[model samples]
Target chain A: MSASVPTTRLQATADAFLTRFAGIKASLPGDKSLRERAAATVRSKGLPGPREEAWRYTQLRPLTDVTFETPLHADVDAQALLGRLPEIAAPHLVFVDGRFRADLSTASSMVRTGAPSFGSGARPDFDPMVALNTMLAEDGVAISVPHDVDGGTIVLASLATGQNGRAIAFHPRHSVNLADGAKLTLIEIGLGDGVYFHNPVVTVSVAHGASLTHLRLQTESEQAFVLSTVYADVASDGTYDSFQLATGGRLARAEIHATLSGPNAIAHLNAAQLLAGSQHADFTTIVSHDAPNCASRQTVKTVLTGKSRGVFQGKIEVARAAQKTDGYQMNQALLLSPDAEMDSKPQLEIYADDVKCSHGATVGELDAEQLFYLRSRGVPEAEARAMLVRAFLDEALEAITHEAGRAAMETAIAHWWDRQA
Target chain B: MLEIKGLEASIGDKQILRGIDLVVPSGEVHAVMGPNGAGKSTLGYVLSGRAGYEATAGLATFNGADLLDIEPEERAALGLFLAFQYPVELPGVGNANFLRTALNALRRARGEAEMDAPGFLKLARAEMKRLSMPDDMLKRNVNVGFSGGEKKRNEVLQMAILRPKLAILDETDSGLDIDALRIVADGVNALRGPDFSALVITHYQRLLEYIVPDRVHVLVSGRIIRSGGPELALELEANGYAGMVADAA
Candidate 1:
């Protein structure tokens, strides 16, 4: 039935998007020829329809209804914006409405960048959102860490602020390249005010023996929409560890595509979404082991309360040549209310005979025995439930190896819980 | 400190505690001994307010407060503690964290200031040493991988920290070696005082040799058929439950 539904939805919204594309296609950054060509690709493909396997869970009807305008560059007070995430004190870069606010960014001596696209080389056939970002991304940071050094923490804070009641959107293309034997920690915090769409495409390339700890804190405004796309490539013996905390946004989807392109490379993706009210948060991840002896682990946890909905779709693909590949994916959800809902789709596609791959999905309410155990110890019902919920999510956050990043993520989770009460 | 009058309860359609009349005044220890299928565990579950236990007819009171009318948490705030035969294993919850949270919650109910982290850790460490538990147990998940003896000891540790006015140890002696049993009895004996009372429920007389309850009651079916002094435990140990159960029948 959804086969025809996506086509209808796409046709209804294609005109609006095409018109918007025409206005910004010429002005988009990058080589003029590349920008125009990306726009043409977007126009030809149109937006992702509901029938598309990935776009099935997330509908675009509400998004199409909004009269989204191009977000013009507006100078912001970086100090005030920085205060929101005062716990993170590192060399930082600030972006407001997809434009870099230089006055607010701290200079880093290790890495440099030209533009950001959640890079486009991976799978161009499916994600029209990537095409959309490729056609409209204004400016993104280019970063590369030096080899054999402990590159401290780099805070990339994206703030979306707009006025005049204009429903606006911005796409920031961010690219990161870590050289062989290099090490770095990147904390990407996305926060905003007012009604807007913060669609960002990020590309990451990790070289031999290098390690990248990427932490994403998406606390967009309740009225805002966020479609974040991330594409990562890990080389021989490299490790890519990422954790995303999705606690904000009306409709938030974090789509990550990771490829272990070299032997002995590792990709660990962990995410936790604490959603309430009418909010919708979805975490979709696809990890492909294209090299022999590669390992990948993805664990996602979600806590839904009130009338919120949470969706998780995780797929592990082991190629024919990827022998001895070890892949594991688990998605767990805890529903706190009768009205709250969750959808989990865990898939394993393995063509290699010697590979080890497994996937698991579980949805449950608070354990009555655990709750009674806590309550019988004098904790009230609410606090006991909150403790269990936090503990449930903490299990997934344990995948974060970097001490500082893990602590920062824990602090963010605490804040989210505090606001929940 | 504890009182139960005609306490009748059941799980689903099956009746368990037919009619139990028991009371332990301040500064006393009472032991309820019964054979299997005597509703010993059901009594524990009903008193702890575990769901699925229906109290059809009962009147239970703790420190002059009607326990049956209040929630399990409120009963806890009144200093009622139940040491389980099988403790829960909270996978991601640290033992230290659970203890501090429970302690702080009790303190909050009494409008007292919360314990600081360092202060809590210090107290917990001391208690661990007193119970012959390793300090690393604090770092592990709450009873996640703990052995049977370790779980019961952890419960005793919690009871030691919470310092309740009335504690109900339900078959805590089950699956414990003589050494573990001695340590557990010592843990409970340390908490005994003029104000602290406990009802130690067991199926064997071995535990009584160490804890030395002031009174021993033999339960048959769903009723306590006999109650006697500490010497009665030795009598039951020598004669066994076959005689007492046959006499009750």
Candidate 2:
């Protein structure tokens, strides 16, 4: 019945992607069967359209207009690009155009590159974006920590440099595995220049009693588009805490799926999206509690100015056997301009009788009383607006316990505020 | 010095202040005592450049600057302050940050250097101690989760930090106890000198006992009907506003 509606444009884009894969599949460094299986799925299903439940707020029509090509071997100023990164005194792995550049990165023991590490945690068969990434992934980093070891911190920076007015496309596949009782802090930074398409997939597995802290900052070019998918699994007493700040890209989307498969596991999926002008950003998350006594929390905030639009879709599912489950989700948005827009959806599917689950959403502009209060105390209009915006994002920002990561996010927020003013 | 000549203002279609003529000279504090809905708060709002309180016909000047022709921040920079009866609550904005931002903004307008963090913290702590406010007040969000008296004290704390020349206390003593009244009065008095002046607007005469005023004026129906010394407040306090309202009528 659904096939009656025409999805020709989406199908054309999907077919074009499959054609691109067929031309470069042999050159790609990964399992051929994995790529072919993902290609067959794309060949039949096409990219996600507005009809898809999860893609209802986002439309992929913009991708159909531009024909993206492979990145060329253009000269890049590695030092200048490195200067734009946060000043963290730790070893970092730098990837230029989705391929690791040893000369630009500091050597680290836990880091490995040159091939795609498509871990078992991701479901390419379920998510179309993951399938797209699986079909064309080239080079990505794999970071692993042994049992009971503390890996401290590692910064994985992915940069896309598209020169000569050519719109390039790159798919990076990365994974992080923490063994039992292990701990690691992974900071992921995505930045680029010129027009490009960045499609990345990350799969994470946290063993029993382990903890993983993931902080991501995506600030791409104004002419770029980014669609990222992250899948995480946590075992007993394990914790997966992740936060991402999306302030760049013409159109961006960050989709995450976290599963608590063991008792007493914890997951926190939080984000702050700051967009202006005609930009559009979407943040979607799904937390499944498969075991009893597990807890999951989400606090997503969006600040939209100009004619920007922001979307937040969060869902929490508690299985019948997952008794004593505690889940909380909240999405709040502040529209700075009358022309700006926001759409928030919070869902709770609970089959457990003794579970505690709650979800809430709120959309509002800056409080007039708060603004007047600030201005009456001698703060200028622009400065008062910036202050209020920072305050609005403070709730979600406070959940970031990593000092350096928090500082980097704060710097990005200040820069975003500067752009608004 | 602050002067208002034949000031007439309105909110929406309803007129609040009708032809108010007042003067508050330097080195003096004057009390504008009146009952509810007598335009007491309206006068303060008008003089502070608050939005939507339209001054249909009036002229307000502070330190020789046209008060009504500028923004609220400009009025604040020109040494005009309004202590709201209900001080607003600002969540996620620390008291120290708010105070320092306001102070630095006014300082920048006056060609003064910005205050360093330690210096600002020291000054704020000293001012808080003088107001009898707990040290944690500076660390908390501005007026968030504060008691009524504590909010009033925070207002006084802001007044001390900003050090405005002309302050319009709009019923600042509405919800204060005896001790808080004394502390708030002390905060106001500490700023009293030849360079400072205040217009203390209130309904009760008790506040005037602590923050003594040089003169008292009776305002009714958007107009001042009587004027006298500080003893007038005591008279009004003993014999309520009924007599004055009837006499003015």
Candidate 3:
């Protein structure tokens, strides 16, 4: 029996959004033509509800309950908001409430960063959240890595401010273009009070032979909501390495879609989602190999405690032309509480006959043997569990090749553990 | 000093240790020799407070503290150590960090000042050299990809570093080669003094050759069948466990 697309409040939200935002779509980043196309897409697609298979495990009903206001306080100070944010010795940029803070940014001449062109473009049919973010995104950060340049750590920190009485939302658009043979590492960090929602959309274009390392640390406020989307298109022989560390927000999701469009291209999507309290976090990824001789790998680990819930939905699609494609994905979840839960769905859609695509998912609690082993060695029960959880998640964090970025992410993980303790 | 009186333990519904009575005074090393299914490992687990191995009908004490009543870490804090028969492989946890953390935990429990990195490194390096472990082992994850002999040697290295009062070694000699057995035995011997004692559990008497025990006890059907001097180990080694099993039956 086919399930019907039930009428939901999200659909009602779509109607309200179109009625309120149809004419003002030009205020969004991108060209006027692109904005027009995006406006049409939003009007046609709308926000998805639980009726959608992709969003079955996630619900946006809370969004429907409260109206999200665009907090564009242009004069929001960056220095004051930088409390507890460690200073990384590298080129960086900061954004407060999705608006860029030039006074707090440091970039080299080899990199040119700005907002997108006044153009419009359409999103893929997979994600419905992109439509909303695209419809309302502001001062998107754009980076241009010159050809053959080995760019150092380019830190991009986004702070969402919810000091206002009303519920605020920040949709920050990000665009990064890596020229041929260029190499760069990008770190995106999200931080703020949990009273807001931070919805970020990122587009990455890796040209032929280019390599980009993208690391995201989403440690937003535990009371906040974060729904992030990333789209990356890789050319021939290009490498796209991405790692996500999500340990914050009341409800958070890191959605990534990587399309291998050229031969010999590679994409690695790895993440560690650590949640406590009543937090809910999801890592959804779709790796599509449209070109022959491409390779993709994904490894995600989650640890949830209390009444928290963790979800993973990973899909690897191999098209007919993608012969000799090698795709591998693994998702492992560790539930720390009897009330805690984990839902995992790993799918492999292989149309080509000569492709090697495999995926596996596992959900479990901390290993009893390992816990006993540590405890017997004089480690307290709490410390023993913490050590084991960190070890389990460290496997996914090791995917990041950039040294400094990996350390920064580790520090963030330590902070989360400290709070849990 | 360690003492067990009318010690009975069970895993699930089946009783493993029917009734065990043994005693080892301070500074004495005692060896418990037995065949398969004689509950040698269960005795160690019961004393160390491992979950599920319940001491249902017995009184065991270490330094007059109820061994079965406290948590495993508390047992460790009271100067007890168990060199596992199978050392766990903990990937992503550095061996050095684990050792340091354990040492600091023990120190905190003792109300002694914690050892800093330099002091710990000095002690750890000397102990590792005594056990013939590579210096690079500090960089690798704890026991991950280690050979059987290496794991056993690592266990002994831990015992050497932790400086516990009483150590229970469960089949610590099962997989070690002759050279490794010698080095590991020397590591234990180096810790021998008036304040340190050991309960060595093994099937074969071969390990007794390396680390000679002051007292030897034959365990069969969960009860101590015979207790004697060092010659008892040689007797079991020569006659085998068949006679002991039949007699116990």
Predicted structure with the largest lDDT when compared to the true one: 2
How accurate locally is residue A5 in candidate 2, as Cα lDDT from 0 to 100?
43
Q: What residue runs in model 1 are displaced by over 4 Å at the alpha carbon?
A: A1-6, A76-81, A110-125, A162-164, B239-242
Against the true structure, whose TM-score is highest? Answer: 2
Tens-digit lDDT string for candidate 2 (A121-173): 88777789999999999878888999999999999998877665788888899
Identify the CAPRI category of the predicted complex in candidate 1: high
Q: Which tens-of-lDDT digit does each residue in B116-225 have in candidate 1?
A: 99999999999999999999999999999999999999999999999999899999999999899999999999999999998999988999989989888887788999
Residue A90 local lDDT, model 1: 78
True contacts kept of each: 0.75, 0.64, 0.69
lDDT computed for candidate 1: 0.85
Score residue A331 of candidate 3 by CA lDDT. 93
Worst 10 residues of 1 chain A by lDDT: A117-126
Clashing residue pairs in all predictions, respectively, total 9, 0, 7
> Taking the tens digit of each residue's C-alpha lDDT, what string does model 3 give over A1-421?
3333334566676776665566556565456565455556767777766767998887776666666665756676555568756566778778877777777777567544456321122273335677666666666667778889888678889886665656777677777888999998898888887478788888898989999999898888888889998889999999999999998888888899899999999999999998899899999998999999999999999988899989999999999999999999999998888998899999889899999887888888888888888888898998888789889987798777778888878898888888888
Clashing pairs in 2: none
* Candidate DockQ scores, in order: 0.81, 0.79, 0.80
State candidate 2's TM-score: 0.98
Residue range B1-249, candidate 2, lDDT tens digits: 888889999898999988988888899999999999999999988888788876899898887788888998999998888999999988879999999999999999888999999999999999999999999999999999999999999999999999999889999998899899899999999999999999999999989989999989999889988889999999899889999788778
